[model samples]
Target: MAGWEQTRRRHRLVHDVAGDFARNGPRALAAWRPAIETEFGGLDDLLRDVQRRLHTAAEARLDALIEAPPADLDTSVAAVLDEVAEIYPDLRRLLDAHASHPAVAEGTVRFHRSVRTATGVDLTRTRSDRSRYEEKGPVRDRKPVFFARLRPVCGWLH
Candidate 1:
């Protein structure tokens, strides 16, 4: 935190994590998602995108280093991998917790839609039909939602 500024910040730290990292180069994430649905049709695609983003961010941070390689980079990636390996257990807990609730997911869709319709902060760039990073996949009940899309940028720091 000394030399480097606190360049990035996210409120939904745990949930929008992949979205957070891909802000640095969201084109990478945009290329990966085959589709995006309201209730999240394919968790695998999201998970894969998250993993790829993690790898890309970590590698980019390390590669852009002007100093000698930090002694802990390897160990750090290892530790991160170890924690990511625990993804299933964590996911199981989350799914178990949300299994009984459906509105909670639907509400997420409303939130995005509201952002598109109401926000003063223009997100139009991200939702463009021509965007290379268009969100794709099936939504709840495997029905494709409207063409609503997002490129998932890195916020300001990202």
Candidate 2:
């Protein structure tokens, strides 16, 4: 086909679509509703997949830290826990939003369990205690309470 002919055809197609939307008004959007709904429905699944990947990576990182004998265990632990602190709020929000989802709940439980195993502190308990104090909602500044608790046992954190 000639280039000009193709351009003309595209212009006609665009005009046709514009005419349909003009005639149909709001009804033009009706065709898109199901696809939009499908996308919205898939968002939960996408979130779940992201959560799972994050948990897996965190768990592996923690395990590596636990297995190695770092010269400065406190600093190493602090570094990893700092990463955890960063992700905790988002993870908590996902948990709250999908509390009914068994997979999300299970992944959260597993992540917390891994943390407890790596650090002596049980974050779930810390979170529960902290939650009681914060009337406004999710605490903005989350300092991993594990450092204070781990200090006595390791004697490395000053």
Candidate 3:
């Protein structure tokens, strides 16, 4: 399969495994892991690649933002918000899939904080609204629904 297709399949597998694990528990998950590792490779390696891709994409986005400054702070913040909104779901999926894994769970926490600090956007939030960027105070309190939804998966992993 093509690289993108393979990545897409891997992502689907992770999502499926996570869903099954949620319903069936660790016993079912344990059986699934061998096939998961066989087809998609190790979870650790997959997560590393996912993080690397996200970081590279973030850097490129930041570079673009720097190269062409927005009209004002609102515009700049909005740009970052939009970028994070686009990226967070995939990252959240990878994190959710391997939340039980020690290294990956720690990485997820770090990634969440770093993204929030850098972009002033709460990645944990499930929904994105362009209007939210209009207000300064509300943005800070934004809940990470995406992270919340995946919390159980991590709990199960442990």
Top lDDT prediction, candidate number = 3
**Per-prediction TM-score:** 0.26, 0.38, 0.41
TM-score between model 1 and native: 0.26
Prediction-by-prediction clash tally: 8, 0, 3
Compose the digit string of candidate 2's lDDT tens values, residues 1-158: 69766545433432333244445653643563454344434434534654664555455556666776477655554455445434344443433445567766676677678677776546665534223322334335665434333221111211
| Model 3: colliding residue pairs | 124-144, 124-145, 125-144
Q: Given candidate 1, what's the lDDT at residue 154?
A: 47
In model 1, what lDDT does residue 153 have? 26
Per-residue lDDT of 4 in model 3: 67
Model 1 Cα lDDT, one tens digit per residue, 1-84: 832332222212223534433343434334434333222345443443333343333233333222343455433333322232
lDDT scores of the candidates, listed in order:
0.33, 0.48, 0.52
> Model 1, stretches more than 4 Å misplaced?
1-41, 65-67, 71-153
128-152, model 3: which lDDT tens digit per residue? Answer: 3223422332333454323322222
| Greater-TM-score candidate between 1 and 3 | 3
Sort by TM-score, best first: 3, 2, 1
